[model samples]
Target: MALRRITQETFDAAVRENVDEFEMDPDEALREAVEQFQSQGVDLSCIVKAVPAATSDDKHQEQTHEILQALESLSVAQDSPDSTKAAADIKCFTEQCLLGFAQRYLAAQKGAYPVILSYCQKSMGEREATFAALSALSALTDGQPDLLDADGKRFLLDALEQHQDDSSVTRAAISAVRHACLKHEQNRQDLVKAGALPLLTSAVKRHSGCAEVVKEASAALRIMTFDDDVRVTFGHAHEHAKMIVLQHNGLKVLIDSAKAHNDNITVLSELCATLSRLAVRNEFCQDICDLGGLKLMMTLLAGSYESAELVRQVLSAIRAVAGNDDVKDAVVKAGGVQLIVIAMNRHMIISAVCEQGCACLSVLALRKPNNCKVIMEEGGALAAVQAMKSHPGVVNVQKQACMLLRNLVSHQPNYSQPILEMGVEALILQALRAHRDCGDAAKAALRDLGCQVELRELWTGKRGGITN
Candidate 1:
């Protein structure tokens, strides 16, 4: 006798009858039905689609019931004398169910967090179970962080402190912390205050070889160091938040991670972005350069990265570090000028990249004869001029371009003729008339160009229009 193939209608009818009429355990019934269908070589996706959607309240109650049941099963397994294997099995099952429930009914999953928290607290000794509980907590917190009450937050931090040697548990805890503080400034502050930062730093240092742990730890650190207020709070009088990162050897771990996972663009991008943000404070710029960040940035710019964000970050870091005259000379000596100009020409349409590129060139040209000469010689001036022309509508690009030109003309008058021959003066004048935000800088550049008469006439027309 041939076996009967289970159609979508047949599977749905079975699930409905078991769930509604017999009041069978929904989780058990669903699992058995799936296994039976798999043994029969029936496609299950169609059956999933055919299942009827529940009303909002029904859906919430359904998710709540499943979560509570999973927690109960985990609690029972934990109580067994030979609980390790059984607990692992139960935790895996619970995690899978919670993942599905969270995805479908995230808001409704809050009611089960207390049970989830208790499971985490109880399963602290069971590594697999603790990891599973933390994973679910991370997912739930990620979808709705408001569900993570103070007790839950403290439990996560306590888990991090206790699991310093356990890579799996530490990674999951870090993931939970990362999600909890993703965009919530208050949560980030709370984590920092709870000593989460040092724990995260230790996680990165200890799990140097574990990519997931390092990724999550670095991501959490990135968030903690992101807020300017947090930086100010953690930093000393004259120092910035980046100093906290540096104190923990965060930069070293970030650089090491980038080197180890050279192919992982997400890790590198986040690392570079965090580094860039840290470099924004002038006090930390030289520190970044001293740590060999300048060399790494040039190498990244030299390589082929498909992420424009990474390039933007590299340029922003370079711009920040170049503010220091010594680092500016270092950048110019390391062939950074040419690479920056190349990035500018390549991503001309990206206003942030263009703005940072021009800002870097402007800073590099600041009273530094070697840097200025390099900019003019390496076609940096042309890149800036072209950026201004191509993206006149971008206010910051125009502002930075005008400032770069002013610096070039003021510090390196020898390049004035070449820059003029490139028709930068025309573009500068156009910027003056087009963007009020850039008029002051544009007027200054024109005056430097010995076009005082044109500047006066343009100002006169503006005054005449205002008077009328």
Candidate 2:
């Protein structure tokens, strides 16, 4: 009966007969009808509806999950019984039920991503089942500020310690940690103290698991391991990076993975960005330069319109190794300036990627005066000028680009004169007109240009700087 689909009247008659007492096949009639409908490419929603919901919430959840799985299996099947419409219907129904239950269940649990972290271990065995639950759970916890509980918080760290073998579980566990970390600084410290950082760094290096899982772990690690104690925890991660820095093929794998998977983009970008951070350390820079990481990063930027995040990450990773004069010269020799300019031009066309691109340009402009010339000439200055004008709505991007200009204009006061001469001062003046956060950077940049306009003039153009 559980294995087949049946009709309303026939299935009702079967249920009434106590058919098992007579050893009757309860779903025999329904199964045949389902198979026939499938063979004719018909939707099976009517037949699927015949299966009764389980008696309790727990059983209902399981049955609902099973229904979702059945739909996925059929949809992906080489010989799907129904038309494409059936698959779409199944996906829609499953997503609605699954997301609805997950949200309500999680809201009931009140910020316990780790509860499903444990429950799914027992309840979910298949890959999609685990991911489905994790994805839904992520949505539930995403912006709910009041959801944290002490017990739920502890479960995340405990799961990391106990379940390192299952990357899937570890991934979800760390995502919970990341949510916690973002919610409170103490939770961030707790993650580092509970050995979460080591486990996450290990998972990121593996890079062979589900991309989403690996990236989430890396992201959690990136968020949690920035301060001093957590930085010490990353010592082992740093050592491991050193070993791989010299291995060309392994470094290539990280870059290629960063470029290919959209799911892996954030974490992979984080890894590269983190590696760039590590590369800022003298010992690590030596290892990266020896491994040819800078050249590979430069190569990544040559082909334009690739993933903006990946390009930004690669540029950041390169700056990690290119800290010294020799490394900077080598990067220039390797066409790094052209690629950076290309990223800058694309920055205007793309969003989000601009942050890192501007970050990379700032890194380069601070070190190389001639590179600033390349940037300003390649319309890098114009792009920054335009960004300063267009992106007052996004504060961080404006801050970074304006700061980059301050750095570039300072680096080559003579060369960047054209940028200043191009009415950039006026644009910065206009960008500072908003009272939002981006306005602060715009005023600072204006000050950098020797225009002693008060903050009030930039924000409200009043006669005086407003003091609270």
Candidate 3:
């Protein structure tokens, strides 16, 4: 059964009661509160679960926290005449924000979002102040998506459009957009409605040499292609991706940027992810090939053999574009299959890299008998077997490895004898028994590899229905 959930305020009240009324120590009171709520089958994962240190004087009792105090000071400085003091105060708050997202979360719960937003609104004309406030706002809203309420979204888009001439401000504002729309679907649509797509792409072009700007803009573009919202019944992921690619020359822009920053692993990783997201159409896949994306990915794959994250992203990009048949031919012609096997060999212990590598090989082998010969000759079968054994508990690794096994023999059943010699039968059987999500994949793999499966019967002229 699911545990019942209580709000943060309720838990805080209970803790406070135990401390102030019962006169218990703060630590003991917090533990007692947690025990009391959890005894009633309550979920406490979302609760902060920490006590704020207290100080008292004759005039005041239980004063505000460090974050709350800093917010109050920044609030007062917003009206002060001394620009230097105001900058210093805001700077202090920005330093506080740099501590971590927990401090930022506590600040937002204490109403810091609106205060800092108002500061941003008032600091527009002053370049230094505007940059500082935007930085603080971006930090404050990092993981606190609730603070984006309509006004916060408007300000982020406005900041993007208003501050294009300044790379620092543009980077900061793009950072805020990347954070604001991360899991918030409405914020994504609203910003795109107000013209954020072109501005983001243009920023990448205007500041291609600025690694920080390119990185942030690339991340923002990728975040815009997410379908991660749980609040809405439907998301605009496909629509947003199409708008970015078809209307904004996203393929050209992203590929060109990737070319410029080939040596920068961070930027290259982000561009690889963005390229994967843009492969939503058949022609889009062909476009990626036509724009030299396939060759670029091949180069990155061979060059970044030691970078686990970059190699994983590169494999994913290859998988995405291989949805096109011609592109698959091109990848195989470019020795993509053998490079994938080498990547799996290099990062065999890393499950993510191995999983993507196997999945990419599976795509390359689909419906192409010649590719299967290359996979077998290049030890792709041995690599898949090792990935399954290394990460037995990882369902994705198991499932993709199973599919790769199946694709390797799908069009060429004569190759099954060699794969079976590698002892993949027991592993496939294990996956079939372990994960229900991958049962069909494992079954298809076994069947295509010329293994016997317990066939089910459903047609004996049953009167009303087929067998269940």
Candidate 4:
């Protein structure tokens, strides 16, 4: 008989009798039928509807579970060349079954998180199983917010926590949480509070040379620490906070990672930013200083022209740590003053990084007047002013220049008189030509410089009507 015209009565019997069929032999006839549909390029929704409703018999239930399990496996293997043909065939069959069950299928069955998590932990040697569970979680999380409740959340957390010190399991578990955290803010907060930071820190320390593990651990912490609510949660985890500080080797490891593997800029940049956040706070500045973070940051900033983002982040990390005079003195002593000026225009290569570098330079100037002198001597001030004029095609860079202007004037008020003397008013006024937040920043900086005749004339030449 042609598969297309299978009688509704036969399909109904299949559904009713094989209520547990999915868990059983996986209904080869059903599998073949779906394969035919796939081969013919037909949608299987109608065909899926033809399957009968599941029977209530216990034996049938077992069979149905098996079928579902098989379907899940097939769903995951669809990409494998060896399994593609069979997997595609099974997808069509499972689609029909899933279509028949509809939302009821999803609703009637428990979400696959527990099963998926279990498979991932035990199947480390089996890349396919680990991949399959990872793929399954993507679909399950897509639909079910309440799928994994508090108990389920706790279970995954505890299981992952147990493997916190194990890099492979840590990587997988962190990957799993990356999705879970998005499902609910509370889940993210719970993970942070449950000692994830320390575990991640430990993993970073132990597996310092393992690029992938460090990347994953850093990524997990990024998601957890990104939101303000999660930050507060991190704050409450005082012991973990201390652990992050005491794990003094993390900064050096990250610095070494970036230096040793230039290809992993993305990973290394994230690690730098993550550590900056954790250790940049006032309480942790001393730890950062003791660990030689200032010198490492200066090296990155001075040398990393290829990765503007990493350099910018390293600079920000320095700012976070440099709030202390000793740290700032260390930074100045390490020649950070000379580097910040060159970074302003040259490393302004990326708009975001340029913005961050600009801010970092401003902070450095505020801390060390001699650094401000380096900025001026290197024409860093002029470069900043021109960056404002050329405007880098990114609003953030313009804003950073304007911010740098504000910092320069505020930190070196007397020295900035020469900048005004050199006709920088026109440049600042040019940035203000655009009526936006950046323009506002430019205008505010100029206004703060007070009134000077050269500055007034420069503004007038640019058709900037300044009333002072």
Q: Which of the numbered candidates is closest to the native, going by highest lDDT? A: 3
lDDT of 3: 0.87
Sorted by TM-score (best first), the order is: 3, 1, 4, 2
Question: Highest TM-score among the candidates is held by which one?
Answer: 3
**1-468, model 2: which lDDT tens digit per residue?**
233434444433434354434554546544554555567565444333233444356733533223344334433531444445433543343353344433333233332344333433432444444444444344444544235456545555555556666776667666766666654555555555555555665655564556876667546645543443432333344433443344323344444445455344555566577557555356556555666566556655675346787777776676667666667666766777667767766666565566666666676677677777766666666667666566656666677787778777775666545667767776666556643666666666666666666755436555785899
Model 4 has an lDDT value of 0.58
Question: What's the TM for model 4?
Answer: 0.63
Q: What is candidate 1's TM-score against the reference?
A: 0.68
Per-residue C-alpha lDDT of model 3 across residues 1-468, encoded as one tens digit per residue: 999988666887888899889999989999999999999999886566777544445435664455666777888888988888878877877777767775687677778888888888887777788898889988888887768777777777777778888899999999988988899898888888988999999999998888898889988988888999899889899898899899999999989999999999999999999999989999999999999899999999999889999999999999999999889999989999889999999999999999999999999889889888988899999999999999999999999999999998988999899899899989999988899898889989998888987555658776785787
After superposition, candidate 3 runs with Cα above 4 Å error = 1-61, 455-468
The regions of model 1 sitting more than 4 angstroms off are: 1-52, 55-116, 143-147, 228-246, 280-283, 305-307, 425-468
**Each prediction's RMSD to truth:** 11.1, 13.9, 3.3, 12.8
lDDT of 1 by residue, 1-468 (tens): 554555444776776677788787767667666776778876553234223444245655432234444444555665567756555645554454445533324223334566567767777776777887787677656645556778878988889988789999998898888877765666776777778767987887788778788778777776665553432344321232554555676666677766776666666666677666555556567777777777888888889434677888778878766767778888988999999888888888788889989998998888887778888888888999889888988888988988888888896677778888888877877888788998788888777766653444534434333553
> Model 4: number of clashes?
20
- What is candidate 4's lDDT per residue for 14-111, written digit by digit as tens? 55444455543446545655565457655444333434333355545533333354555544554456644533434343343333333323322543
Each prediction's TM-score versus the true structure: 0.68, 0.56, 0.90, 0.63
Find the 10 residues in a row with the least total lDDT in model 3.
52-61
Candidate 4: residue 447 Cα off by (Å): 3.1
Candidate 4, superposed: residue stretches over 4 Å from native = 1-148, 158-167, 182-184, 228-243, 246-264, 421-423, 433-436, 452-468
Candidate number that wins on TM-score, 1 or 3 = 3
Clashing pairs in 2: 5-30, 6-30, 38-81
CA error at residue 156 for candidate 3, angstroms: 2.0
